[model samples]
Target: MSTGSGAPSAPAPNSHHDTVSDDATATASARGTTPGIAAGPAAPPRKGTFSSLRIRNYRLFATGQMVSNTGTWMQRIAQDWLVLSLTGSSAAVGITTALQFLPMLLFGLYGGVIADRFPKRKLLLLTQSAMGLTGLTLAGLTLSGQVEVWHVYLVALLLGLATVVDNPARQAFVSEMVGQDDLRNAVSLNSANFQSARLIGPAVAGVLITAFGSGWAFLFNGLSFIAPLTGLLMMRTAELHKVDRVPRSKGQLREGLRYVSQRPDLIWPIVLVGFIGTFGFNFPIWLTAFVYHVFHQGAGTYALFNGLMAAGSLIGALLAARRAGSRLRLLVGAAMLFGALEITAALAPSFWLFAALLAPIGMVGLTINVTANSSVQMATDPLMRGRVMSLFMMVFMGGTPLGAPVVGWVTDAFGARIGFLAGGVISLTAAGLIGLVLARVGGLRLKIDLRRGHQHLTFVPRAPGAAAPSGEKALAPAA
Candidate 1:
């Protein structure tokens, strides 16, 4: 479904900060994703894995997001299934998906510009309310037996419009909540929360879809916005880590683009994800085909598949939350594994075998998401974060508009296996190429050891005196 913004412009809340610890700076220098802010004294480590939650504002935000993200997942399942049922064509499902993300493709950067200038909390309130209204409208039409394919299309477009702002704002807002010190942890935990909801949302959506109809799921999703709206209202603005707003300007968008282009640490990861997102991450298309066509399963099994994937994603996100830094090598490695797993899953001989592979796919997928997200946010200047993240997300989700329909057609004509396999090959190739380029930029080369009980693989400096800026400047030092 889609949502729109009828709310008139209001002044936005301020932005956030960028800082790194000495240790994190050294590690970043070695990895090529440093924030480029000079190293400060080493900061004490966070007391626990959930250190970000120690901040009251972040805790409130997290609790609220957990509810809404689940709702969002529910809508995704119901919307896709509903479209497939109505049209009886996976390509139609693809079209629905494309429409939903097309706005991100077309207008995502503008959303980022708005996000930088506005108060995120207020922006979220507006966006969330609009999204909830769209859900309610869709629910009402479906429940009243007046809904049509056209109605779904309209709602999806509207929703995408709202998301163009909501997504960039919400992502940049995280750093504002906990500051750079706990930014990575917060980002990881946010993924865990989304996946946690993924597990529950699909199951619930499955049950609701089967028993009543998709309408109830939509209705529940509409109401789910209440939690976040309440949370946004309750947050103490004074407690937020506020930064100066970017004054309105004509060339701001170009500035964000230029910023990313100059930084290899930021650009390569974004480029890697763009390729991966455009091809490999067509799960909605792939999974729907597997369930409806290949496995001949009902809604319950589809939900089960999603839940299993969610389980793995949750594990990966939690693991990421515990670490103090994000490495380009780690991100590259995860992307490779994700692609390999997808190829394997596509060729699985049995339904159960196919299902079993999904969990790991989900795991590595979350790893890529968390790693790339934190790394980019860390390396960006605070003033440009909204625009940078918009670019990151646009390259990621926006690519769906280009990929989903093509993947859907491939599924329809060549069979789901061909479509899935093609995506995997592209993903793996992209990851490998990006990894090599990043390694070269870092002035490092892969080292291999043939002996038993020795380290089998590592990256070493190409020359003793070589400076790997990508490693040294990729991320902020741990703070």
Candidate 2:
């Protein structure tokens, strides 16, 4: 929707190491010191929600990504329509989606390692170029009337391979561009950029598909890569804030795994994401099925639903940008709300009513995504950012391969409504369980208070040695 490797030798917990300068910078930033900047009088308050745009590199990156992300979404819509046109089967669509994400499930961890070991800008140049070429090849094949489902499958796999590297590099690179102080805002704005592109891309793809054919949409997407490539080339390398490159080590992957294992703040969110992503995030499959089978609609109607959802997502992202930090409570509440709305939408009797529900559904979904992403990035060590983010993405996006096919099959066999219901149930259950786990493990107790004739439930930290609940330690703040 758009929404690891084999076991190695275990490394000692908390034994992860990094360059002294990088470690010092991270520590200073945690203490409110601007890393690499001379101390001076208090800076003026940031002006607006888009404060991260003040940085030259991030501005360039965001502008380029806006264009590229639109193209990416265009291709996504075109590809799905093409598969449906070729096979007329929802299960085929699911298989295609699964193949696209299979590499992430297999080698995403290795991609994180690569991101950590190399210059992020250099790696991004290579990956982005490779993705562009893949897009062009697909456009040519489709235009020449030689395209087949297998061709689509092959191209999707290639793109997925590129993304395995691109995703982690892009995520970790944000720290270098804006430093820690604005990371949450930067991450939120990135989501806003993506969703805004989503608002434009699918609608355009729908028109292109209906007016000409899927080939033109693919061709447009192929050419759209130029914007990101140009932006990357134009970035001033000297102005970039550089993090330390991780040195080669035998047990580094194991070390990343061990590090994540020990942090409840990190692990629980990842686990919750894994559940929701696997079951809840199959929008392409579910939405397409609902449009074609349930509503008896065409390409325009499918695009409309997506556009509406993106509109909500954009609003949610902008709201997140106005905030200074991420919290577990926000993540949990958003997930539950997203799941509940999805369930309600699934039961809608009319297409218009169903479409109306998608807006709020998109809003809560984006809220969960931004909160989870920012919290993880902010709480992680700089040296471990790539590996940690790779793991987070692996759980979030990689679960698609495992879930899409099954969800597609369920939709085909049962109905689109049941498929949606299944996803919502899984998401709701995951949020409830994870929330309770976090509360118990973090020494938080839920207290119900009556005020102004209203009852409220609040989680408050308990007193020391006050019979703390037996569980893992609460997630430590970013080190």
Candidate 3:
């Protein structure tokens, strides 16, 4: 079942949410209609990293995402392999990737607007179904020997369009399932779930493509949509926490942008991730180049590199799931480590050492992703979450299309090592610059205390005349 009130309004900027368990629970209690929110009524939620699974709705959602994510990963690998086989040019694979992410760059904001206007549950159902069909169609074409580069390109673009809507709605819907109490845990688990699929999906695709053909892999991907569809159908709608849907209106796109611009915390992290996503995360191109040209190895070595990275990523996500908080410091710290590791790996002398570095790099990269995602979602208003998250997804993912061609050119011209090193330099520089900017805006100054057992470093209050971060209050110095 779907839930939405007509002409819903957003919460005020300074509105108090502490009184409510979260936006959904607050809405439910206010209406006194929805059930399954109170602890007494439901079974005690599971503890630690898997706590979010305690909610029946979330449990079903996670199960579906797990299966669907694996299929999605399979399709990603198979699609690229199919395109490369047909065209025999690495450029063709890049084009396929660009086409898939291009929609997010172009129209992702409007997709968020639509998500805010409709029921997230229903939107997900539609998008998930559409994705499934696209997979099936591609499978049919491949199995029939009718597949072409153009056909793959077109399907990639269609899938990207579906993702533009799916990403934001799917992100915002987590809060609806578990409320704020479990939102952080759920977000971390979602990352873990994807990474776990990353481990399974690519390996499975490699086998399927080699054994039966890429067509069979596509067929499995096409069929994988069943899990998510079934999960959505099985969900008990009444138990879902409510979120106010924004009614259709003009300037919503601008409204979302403006809202983000005014919030320093939101905008800075988004900016930091955007830089990391665009320049630092071009792994497919970089890793492949390293495997063939630098390491003088074949597909097997590349697969090993990817598998180690996925293992690290899985570790990072699970660790994040255990923690209840998301901090900007964690986000900044993880990004720095990620950038530094990339630079180190790029310059490594031995293949074994380089391969070993991949795991830590993947771990830190996942930390950056999961931290940014959870922090952004936790900070945004429930009413504006869809739009805010849309922007987050846009900058984090959509930048790839724009960045990939440039990164590809650099790799082609200067060699893979230089390209990888340059990406790390940019990422590290951006994190440092953004960290300073955040401190300046927040009216915070660094204070170093060298006393034993005391904090070695921290942010201290700025001088009395210093401006506050927002129009709100600032930290005053202790008398």
| Better structure of 2 and 3 per lDDT | 2
Which scores greater on lDDT, model 1 or model 3? 1
Q: Residue 250 lDDT in model 3?
A: 87
**Residue 224 CA displacement from its true place in model 3, Å:** 0.6
Q: Sort every candidate by TM-score, greatest first.
A: 1, 2, 3
Question: Which candidate gets the maximum TM-score versus the true structure?
Answer: 1
As a TM-score, model 2 comes out at: 0.89
Candidate 2: which stretches are off by over 4 Å?
A: 1-47, 453-455, 462-479
Better of 1 and 2 by TM-score: 1
How high is the CA lDDT of each candidate model?
A: 0.82, 0.82, 0.78
**What's the TM-score of each model vs. the native?**
0.90, 0.89, 0.86
Q: Which TM-score value belongs to model 3?
A: 0.86
- Model 3: per-residue Cα lDDT over 266-315, one tens digit each: 78889999999999998877776787678876545556777788899999
lDDT of 1 at 252: 90
List candidate 1 stretches off by more than 4 Å: 1-47, 469-479
- Model 3 worst lDDT window (10 residues): 1-10
lDDT of 1 by residue, 1-479 (tens): 00001211111212122223567657756756433432322433544567778888888888988898899888989998888888878888888888999999999999999999998889999999999999999999999989889899999999999999999999988877877667777888899899999999999999999999999999999999998899889988898998778999899998889877767667888999999998998887889899999999888888899999999999998888876567678889999999999999989999989999999999999999988887777667778889989999999999999999999999999988988999999999999998888777665678899899988987666655344453333322211
Give the Cα error of residue 402 in candidate 1, in Å.
0.3
Superposition error at 467 for model 3 (Å): 8.1
